[model samples]
Target: MPTLSAADVRAALLAGAEIALIDVREEDPYAHGHPLWATNFPLSKLELEAWTRIPRRNTTIAIYGEALGEDLAPRAAAVLAALGYTRVHRLEGGLAGWQAAGGECFIDVNVPSKAFGELVDATRRTPSLSAQEVKQLIDTRADIVIVDARRFDEYRTMSIPTATSVPGAELVLRVRELAPDPATRVIVNCAGRTRSIIGTQSLINAGLPNPVAALRNGTIGWTLAGQTLDHGASRRFPEHVDAERREAARQAARGLARRAGVARIALHDLRTLESDDRTLYRFDVRTPDEYAAGHLPGFASAPGGQLVQETDHHAPVRGARIVLADDDGVRADMSASWLAQMGWDVSVVEPVDARERGERGQPAARAPQPAESPTVSVATLAEWLGVKAAEGDAANGLAEGHASRAGAGARDTRDTRDTRDTQDARAREVAREDVDENAAQRADEARREPLAERSARSDDASADVAVIDVTASANYVQRHIPGAWYAVRAQLRDALTRIPRARRYVLTCGSGQLAAFAAADLRGLVPDGASVYVLDGGTLAWLAAGLPVEDGETRLASPRIDRYRRPYEGTGNAAEAMQAYLDWEFGLVEQLRLDGTHRFEVL
Candidate 1:
């Protein structure tokens, strides 16, 4: 019941304390970097199934997650104790404390998939170069391409001279697209930090050819260094546009929409349709919290990922068009991008011009002029931003929809009511069959186990057991223990099919590594009262212990990569995005370094 410090945990490690170090971060973050000798049981997943993974019922369970430096440590400790972990203890101060105390975090690059991700980040390293350095590099004609990695509008507002707009996140994927010449030296920059630093690191990790770095401190740095920023750039439409700006962007967007053959609807159309309830799905593709606070009264929020992931589920009207709302042009554009790609007859239903606030009263600031001999057209930029905004919008929309759907009106009620009823009926039937079948199967499995071994794992956890076998399809079909079925990590969603209505579920993976990931993913799908678990050793250990082995080919094939494509699909020039992303990333690193708060761990 005592709290454990990183130092205390270190002592435990040295003394060989029989404790499992659990990372409570999301699966992707865990895959990126985590404590050595620690197993991942994402906190989200652990809340529901702690008993399944930590069934010792007596050993101390230690939990840690991201470096927000808050009370998650104690909170997790409390949750564990409540779950009957008995002597649950918090890792004092979490991973940050562990790192500060010279503890090691581990990164395994052996797995090609995970290694690829790290490489993408590492290869795109863009350290922030001082303004003097940038000026010096440019003056000397040192083969560098200066990229303004902020929004194109931001670039137009005020940016370093000769800088092109390349946003973050797109950095890794769009590098070559921006600077086609492999030998070009790339300088990425943003208004400030975080995005720039992450962007730069992402490219370096991905292994870009050119030497990349950021403009230290970004545009602020440039101005502070007595370097002039260009104010003659064209404006990118604002999220909440004023009358003048709104008119400008509207006119511009109208022209573009006409070119794309898309019809634009006003807010009146939105309101008129809202009351009709005619299977029309209105989406606000903004951030999750934004969608939650308040949205157009009739809209069902569907952030980008979920919107796209369950496109057919959320909006079955393949032919039915969608109206998008966003204060910022970014969300609308990004969400539209994805919806367009998903074959939705989608268009940015720009907010009514009456609600628009033009930039008339705002102080005159530096804005980018339309390029005289421009390499990229405004129309091209609009298309790019529009698409990205749509995708981003969809993501934000999906996050909001997820949060709101818990309380919102039944979406697709007409179709879902029958499906829900059928599923419920099917669940009851399945439970009845499972009870009888599992009872007989349990008897047979009981016969294989040594008396003592059976008792060791068979505490109440196994009685009303729900087994989720997280492995390749081939592995599961070949010879999973009787009821164990496949829960592919990537398509882990499909695992919902096998879930029993009346039992606690326990997930198993190849080496216990993926078991934790699966359990975390499947946590949401478990029935209202059922608990979930992960087999400590997975199939490897089960087989190592001489358990039965079955072999059948799995249906698993690398799923079509097409689904992973964003809706507002564009073949983003990764270099440009990488540059923009690095601009923010390096800026963040510099700030963190200057503030003396960034904690880096040697893995």
Candidate 2:
């Protein structure tokens, strides 16, 4: 396999060339450290996710893995090559070589977003308050409305006692409704820092009347200060904003977006941008429920706040063009402004005509198909296995028939009748046993244990069980069971090897659908002695039951190989992680210093 030097990769990024620096390790390992622009593509999920992630087969893909002992990059390169990925290469010395060459190594996933947040703070000196100071205000009953900038689920997990969930993107548009009085102080927070900073700055950028600030260092700082956080909180901003307020927000956001150099393009220009031979990501920056009601064709639902937070996950191609759309211009304009400052080639388009709207559930695009596919349909593979089994059974039956015929020739008619009856009775017994065994297998495959039952089992001294949360990293971080381990369904086979040995496995997702699929996959991979069950109704059911939930990434039965941690996510992030992240962000200004490729201009 061909190899690319770390310096060469840096040069490509600097030159604005299209390249994918993929870290082919599990999420947890990948999160420990990687290049600033590197995207995680675990070797175990290469076959399942590579095509979709790296859609262009001919695109340059540089694979890297653990620097110390084993090298999974070479093997990963082979897999990509087999999949018809034409331009695959291994990073010359792996991640260590990159560090040796003075290339930045950042901890956590979504390095781009986190680094950008740090950069924004460094450049703009975004205002903030210490967790202790904010807590004191709450105790004094200050006129403040804390807006949690994270997702609703995250807010539900842990939030300030009186905070309301407004998310990041919605902060600007809805702040007027949340706090109409100019004297009311508005504070934004996230699990850690990035969203809090971004959300706070967003309101400031839009020139909101109220005094706005970030909860310094976010929930992590709060925990460090020994502040108690509310758990399972459900307070949220109103679903509907008045038209007059919406118009005012649109004007404010548009001005800010324009000042930030976010291009306002038409549909025709979008068509031209799409034809430029560069990657383009179109998203509707609205709530999922609103998006489900209606959205432009070819646009995926990516609520503006989450999109900014998880830009890498949504559009891994750093140099790609991102076009955001919304029925109301406020959301997209504000979102585009932040994305532009984060170094994305971002634009906002006017909402499409109602006739141009697509169905609610359609995806932005289909997953890419592998070049030289070696996969067969499940039905076909099952038929093939059945045929092979039947062939063996037929041979055994023939041998038995021959033996019976030979014996029959030497026996009387009455004796032959007895032999025939005995054989018939034995066949019936075997058939009944087969039926019973099949029923048992089916029951095992379809079993769904309720959360209460699973919790009880875990509490039991003798029960041997493992609980796996197969949701995305962001979701798992927001809230999950006390002892659940996070894993991606596509990489479950490899994850299972790392998970503790157990007689039974319980799988759960946001809802039970993905968990059900994962459970079936686990059953096929595990030994017959091992059983798998899906959580009935998944984590939502757990919440409904008012069971306690844990926050932050914890108890990894499998390595946190499913998602990357944002520098701002979780509590007690290492000092090294924070400094390394800032260093990488500082380097980006210089890294993009020479790259004429990014058309970014900060207001």
Highest-lDDT candidate: 2
* TM-score against truth, every candidate: 0.27, 0.68
Clashes of each: 91, 4
What overall lDDT goes with each candidate model? Answer: 0.47, 0.68
**lDDT (Cα) of model 1:** 0.47
In model 1, the Cα lDDT at residue 16 comes to 39
Q: For every candidate structure, what is the RMSD over all alpha carbons to the true structure, in angstroms? A: 27.6, 16.8
lDDT of 1 by residue, 174-266 (tens): 455555566887888766443454446444544566777867666666655667777646432123334553343334334433443444577
Task: Give the Cα error of residue 317 in candidate 1, in Å.
Answer: 3.7
Instruction: State in Å the error of residue 356, model 1.
Output: 14
Best by TM-score: 2
Estimate, for each residue in 408-513, the C-alpha lDDT of model 2 and write its tens digit.
Answer: 2212111111122223333334434444554534322322122334445534532355678876554566566656777766566667776777776777665544
